[model samples]
Target: MGFPRWSRLGSDLRRAPGRVRARVTTARGRGGPSRRRSRTSHADPPRGGSCRPGRVGSRPHLRRHPRGHRGGHLLSTARSGDSGGECPLHRAAGARDISRCATSPPRHREAGGVRSLVRQPSRAFVSVRRFIAFGVAIVVIFSTLTARLYDLEIVRGDYYHQLSEQNRIVRLPVPAERGGIVDRNGYVLARNIPGFAISVIPVDLSRTREDELSQRLAALLDLPSDAIGDVIRAQRIRNPYEPVRISKTPVPREIALVVTERAELFPGVRVDPESIRFYVDGTLYAPVIGYTGPITEQELAKLKDSGYLPDDDVGRTGIEDVYEQFLRGTYGWREIERDAAQREIKTLALQRATVGNTVSLTIDDRLQKLLDAELRKGVDEDKFTQAVGVAINPQNGEILAMVSIPGYDNNMFARGISTAELAALNADDRHPLVNKAIGDRYPAGSTFKMVTGLSALSAGTATRDTVVNVSASSFSVSGTTFYDWRAHGSLDFVHGFAHSSDIYFYTLAAGTPFAPNVHGVGPDAIAKYARMLGFGAPTGIDLPGEDGGIMPDPQWKIATFDEPWTIGNTYQEAIGQGFVAVTPLQLLNAYASVANGGTLWQPHLLKQVTDAAGKTLPIPQWTSQKLDMTQENLRLIREAARRVVTIGHAYMPNLKIPIAGKTGTAEFGASAGKDSAGRNKLGFHNWFVSFVPQADNTDPTAQIAMAIFTYDSSKSLCELCLNPAVGMTQRILEQYLGPNK
Candidate 1:
């Protein structure tokens, strides 16, 4: 397009110099009306006066209304014929006057009014949209949750029902009572006595009374004041509800005192029955029987790992320790109903606990008592530092009676001993806690000669008629002089053992038959026979701490002594010295071998185990092995041992029945002390092992074998410890085994 004539004229005007300028402005007042600004209006209206608009924009076709006379103005928003501006007009204005209104004064009210109008609907729309969205989301979520609830409660009902039941029903364990221990004749050795103990439920104590209650309890129970305060403080810090044991195994007087004073002194104190272990025979078999005490913190830690509870009791030693599982019974539980506050309302369900089994030992009560009295006398007479005496049935390896010197009152341990009392017991030089029967390992002395003889006979290296001519009381081996206690003339094997001639055995250990590998039997052979006779190994006795006595061999010598096995070592072992050591029980078991005609039976204390209903459980069976040896050799050895007691010495004549025994006096350390007779007295261990014969081939009802040792600081060649064994043996045999064979 071509430029209009007006536009061309305007351009020429702009180009002309000194052209007159014209300005125009339009102003609207809120949404009400617009104001007009004109060059003519400035002259027409005086200052501070109002001027009405004739037209608002171009392309208006309305007439202007007369001023005053209640006339209304009409405004129209329209697209301009020449531009895109809104047209405004009065009710009387014409289109010719529309252009004059375009340049008007700005209306501040109109601008603010338009903004307010525009923002109102937008705010309402936003609010509505958000509300709808939130409603839809909430509905969807509600539907999903309801469907899941239906599925869990109804669709998979059984599975969830079981889960709910499990949450509601709680099962707890009920500890079993430990089995009672009794003697062979049905005398109660250990039994449980019922008693009441004071306990405090921490939660039941009111906060205001807590400290006061602790002080009162401390005074009443004779507990440490600090300890009582500590317990109360700890309970408050922790759960504040768990029960604390104030005192255990309280006596009847204490119980009665507590009952009378509990209401005034404490709010939580309660008396509950608790089982306490009792030793009926007191100190009779304290060492052998042992005792039990409360589970310790360290022991509790181990037991917890093994699934044991705090209330469980455990056997500490002896037979009780060996049979802990059988003696400690199974645990069961009852489901109890409680409120939200844990107040036990009632028993919702009940399950009873199974009681422990009762144990019957193989120990004889009467015989054990007899042996204890006599052995105690022997211990008293010598004023020995320590000693042990054990008597066993040789045929079956049943322990008849075992006694340890410096015996203790097991009742002290029954309820648990005080620190001062325990220290007092241990303070004495003589140990009372030691179970010497199975725990003490000492040199068997000449008592081991029978084992040597058996091994020689079994190896086919020597016979009963074997003889060794001795020129003197002493013999030299590898440049070391070994002497016999008694000086004797040329003696056969029988005379050699009867007189205990060291020269005869020393020659036998070094003679032609043994010269090939002198030292009668080397460490290897001696150890083999020792093991065969249940030495150097546990005897399988139902007791804890039964040591496997030392049976020195070449390997042991290298391992322990770091020394090589030599002929001297073999000779030392041949005469039961060197590194060879055996417990009193081991020696007794070995004698039983000879008494039972070469058969070795497993020695046991647990005779049988039974259930609560008296139905017997399966008895533990053991296999017996017979040592391969000729009866003729055994008979000759028996005769030689018998001669030591009968025709050989006056001590033998006093034995009522046909008793065979050998005394041992092995020297240890130095001989410094003297007996009543001023002579070089030697330190010695005394032993006498035997079995009474009932028939030609069978053992007596009770084949008695006694091994007793008296620690003599004096080096008296004449052994005095054997006196009691001889006296006790004679009395027992006469009373039980009748007269001579």
Candidate 2:
């Protein structure tokens, strides 16, 4: 009861923070040895008893000391059960019987001097496992941190480094300069001029101040504020990152200076150097060269992968459209380092732009001018609003000059045509926007008679010696009568061809009751010869939008009108009067075949091409085909055509240089209203096509063949009508052809 159990006491004290040793000394008493003996204390070691605190040596055997104490023997001052006697060690262990005490101690020890508490396995700890857990936790935490550092710095370093650079680096596009167009004689037809364009960044302009920005830009551009706002709004909806081009064309220098000099006033506006297209003699050569315009949203969607941007300009028509792939050069870019605010600090790398290829046309500017002037003269003198003229070399079908009156200026389109200007062009009655040379179709008139005449020659139905009874003004077939312009009396085939006798050709096309029994060449034979000489189809010229004019046969007529083909239709088609149409280029090439020993070549405008480095490039291969007519028949046709200019209605035999030609007058307006006299009130289309010989007619392919067509002339086919088309073409040929050649 005086001390703790020996096993637990030793462990508990040794695990404490400090070593403990306890001692007790006898005190000096007044009564010598008796007092000293009474103070001495000894008892057996206690079992099944609690130690008492702070009452040392009252009733005890021996007490263990706690940690951090030295020179001490512990004791208790508690009274024993049923015994109140005082005892130095349980009051009776010193002399009396200790059976009165409830518990007895195991072994007793007496300490005369100081005693120390030093138990075995001395290690300082209340709980050693908790400290071990803390040490392991520290080691694990440090190991995890080291492994994470290895993964970050070594495994994925390059990838994150590239990402860091990309956040500060950007690439900007560099547009290439468009190419120039020249004529065969090196005359500049189209080129590019340095200019500036205005652009606006939608994100740069504050949403609340967008209206003010639009108003300011409208004042400078002379455009509606609402229109400018619409453009900005559209760009913001599409993409907030890209800049939108404010001006579709080049901005004036004065306006560009205002945007660049006063940057604060225009927050989103920027000036960029943009090349503007310049076309020399735009009006004169509009149909041949064509124009360009800015790319639309729909076009950009299709061409985004092809390096085309929203601000790029694209070819619209003619050669510009036909050769667009070559003319549109590849774009370049500049890699630049930028700051956090996205302002470029320095150029990191750059790729230079490659300019577009240079294009040279086969057109002779001088001849083109001549053809244009001559057609203008015809329009004024003949009182017509529309006309077409085309001249080509008979040898290889290279077009020398082509003109379509009521033509528009290509420069206006290149400069961004306004809504009103474009509407006016589309609304004009004469059609200034249409290219009549190749896009429009008309009756070949008597110009088509050569096709029928050749068909009859090949069929052997009518020969040069064959005669037709053209004394009658009209020829009757299938109860439907077809009339000629007038009766030429009785005539031979060659003489009938020279005078353009419709009755003579009709008799050969569909047999009539004539002398020597002229046989009829069926409708298929006529169509065959028509197609053979480049009629009834497009010539596949280098220009865009060519019409394959109508060539009606029995099958075609049944498919179109759902009616049976009558012989009367054959008679009408024989003279190029009904269901027979051709483009101006197709008509000219038809005659070119006859004059050039029966070779009908494909027409082309591009002569050659060169790149930016002055190296020649391969040109596109244009399709060509030769006519299927014999040389003997070609000679016969040439002689008869020469007679048309010498002794027929063309009538131009006085010149030293020789030429051959034919004149035609085609009737139209079957659907027109009646006149004051209650007549059907038909309109006539006048035409004259010719070919010029060199010094001699021996070199036939070296000649130049031309065609002139005037639309809706009142006096084009009247009594004693001079045929203004013939006059215009004859003048052009006289000036264009030389005697020495």
Candidate 3:
């Protein structure tokens, strides 16, 4: 039979039969048995053409091929001119040249019948492969999601759960009542009174309710509606859920009752019980008891760790401040469960607050009142700028009574004083805030004469009988005339101290031309004895802000003024003038030392501290030191001090109880006018330091030392005007001593 024309194309396809056979074998392995059958028979090539799966039927089923076998069959078909049928590559290549027809294998041409070797894959095979691939992708996606689920639900479940619970919980602070302060006699000085304070919870109120609530609160609190609204808005920005204090001022009992009864009308409003500080005799005890005020930002920074809140009140000065740790009670808190709208569902837990400790001061209430009255009287009568009085028990250094005239009421601070009132107080020149008894400094004046006399006796420069003649009222030293208020022709140590003879003391401090005269004790011994008696240093009183008086010496003069110490300086110091200054407490303590025969006691105000349960706590013990004075010198000095009251200008002739005291008239300020001989007239600072019971008494507890200080600006130098401190001292003594027999 003759060969068909299509048989010629089979010859061309058979040219690359080895390559085609290899590709067919690879496709079969990848597809397995099912894929092999489908690829071979279902999509077989017809005659001399290559068959490719239809692009439009389904997505191409990717079969894994060996490293370099991909598209090998297609490349072979493109190279062969006879592709058995119209191959895709032949069409892409345009018309095939008939010149290559002679190159066909004769064996291929000899065969008239041609077989289709390549097959077209069925749509079912493509669909099955696509479904299998999609199923694998779904399995991979599910496996990844399961891992994430395990991590979120099991690995960190507790941490996330706690965060969820926090959103439903709220904490609130409970303020503790501050402690009470009392006098040694069990009289309450500071206490708290129960009252009501208005607070607003911002989270519990809506915008519309806020305006209504503000108006209601303003009517009840006597505040402007806008002010209440502003406060609520500002507090909401800081803490939306916490209670904001609308008014800390204590509402009247009736008003509080009304608020509580009508609670339904005022949403988010609360009237909570609060303690307000009260002072029984606030003005009288202000200096010693101090006052309480709202915590300042500076104080809050320091005390915040100790449970202090920003709105809490704290002690600002005096004993209240010094013992703040014990007086400010520990605050407690409550944990409550709340709903989404921040309404309290239930209290989960609560910690109760502890009360503060009680402080008992050594001040005698009656005596304090008496002294305050007397000092105030003196200040009023004398037209004095300022005055301070202090009384101490010589035996134990207990401050029996202390008074600073023009004292302020501590209740003002407790109740909250306005800025204008505070400014007025600060503007006052008298300095009402200062505890002048211990904080103010003044010249020891002639009260220091005792120290000079004692020093002379201790140094053996003079004895009780050592005499100096005061023929002239004034004695000259380095051309500076040291004048005596009055002259005595001649006087011994006891008599000179009794008369407060300036010339006599100047002779002892600086040498003079007198019969039986001795060398002066000099500024060294004077300052030595003064300092040994607690002068030129703080008295170590329990109170804060004590001034250490100045005791000037040769070195001090050189250091302070770059001037050499002269006889004039020594003379001035001998009579407690010049640079010999001392606080009233220091003077009182020094006299106490002399009265007790040499022991200098550390003055104190606090006597005891007790807890809320009434258990006594350990307190600072009484401290004292024996001075450098010998028994003989103390006796002589004590006798002279006794004579100062008995026979000198300080004498209280009407009193029966024996008292010893020294009077001083310290010169200060500019010399207003010179005398006819060019002598300068000076102003005076009056001073008096004394103690009850003569030095001969052995009972330490019976001895009481005191100091009175006042200023005099009068240039006339009248004895009465310059000696108001002496009269005030006598009045205090009379009140303390009673009718003596």
All candidates: CA RMSD (Å): 10.9, 12.1, 11.2
- What would the per-residue lDDT of candidate 2 be over residues 1-741, giving only the tens digit for each residue? 233344543453354334334222122223331111112233311232222222333544455333222345454544332232233334424423232222222122221111222333324352576789898999999999988877777888787778778868988888998888888888999888877888888878888888999999887776688988999999889865557878787865676898889999898887988888889898998988899888889999998999998788998998788888878887889999977655679999999888899899889888888889978876887567688989898888889888999899998887667677888999998888778989998887887889899998988887888888777777565577777768788888778988888888878888776554877898999999898887778898988899999998999999999999888888879888789988989989988878888777889898889998899999877666666667777888888888887788778756655778788888876434566678676777888888887744534754578888888754324532577787777677767665432
lDDT of 1 by residue, 643-680 (tens): 77765532555444677777666666557576678866
User: lDDT: which candidate is best?
Assistant: 2
TM for every model, in the order presented, reads 0.71, 0.76, 0.74
lDDT at 172 for candidate 3? 78
Question: What's the true lDDT of residue 309 in model 2?
Answer: 89
* Candidate 1 deviant stretches above 4 angstroms: 1-175, 206-234, 246-267, 296-307, 425-429, 477-479, 512-519, 670-682, 695-702, 720-724, 739-741
Over 194-230, each residue of candidate 3 has an lDDT whose tens digit, in order, gives 7777888887788788888899988776668898999
User: Of the candidates numbered 1 and 3, which has the greater lDDT value?
Assistant: 3
- Ordered from best to worst lDDT, the candidate numbers read 2, 3, 1
Judging by TM-score, tell me the better candidate of 2 and 3: 2
Candidate 2 Cα RMSD (Å): 12.1
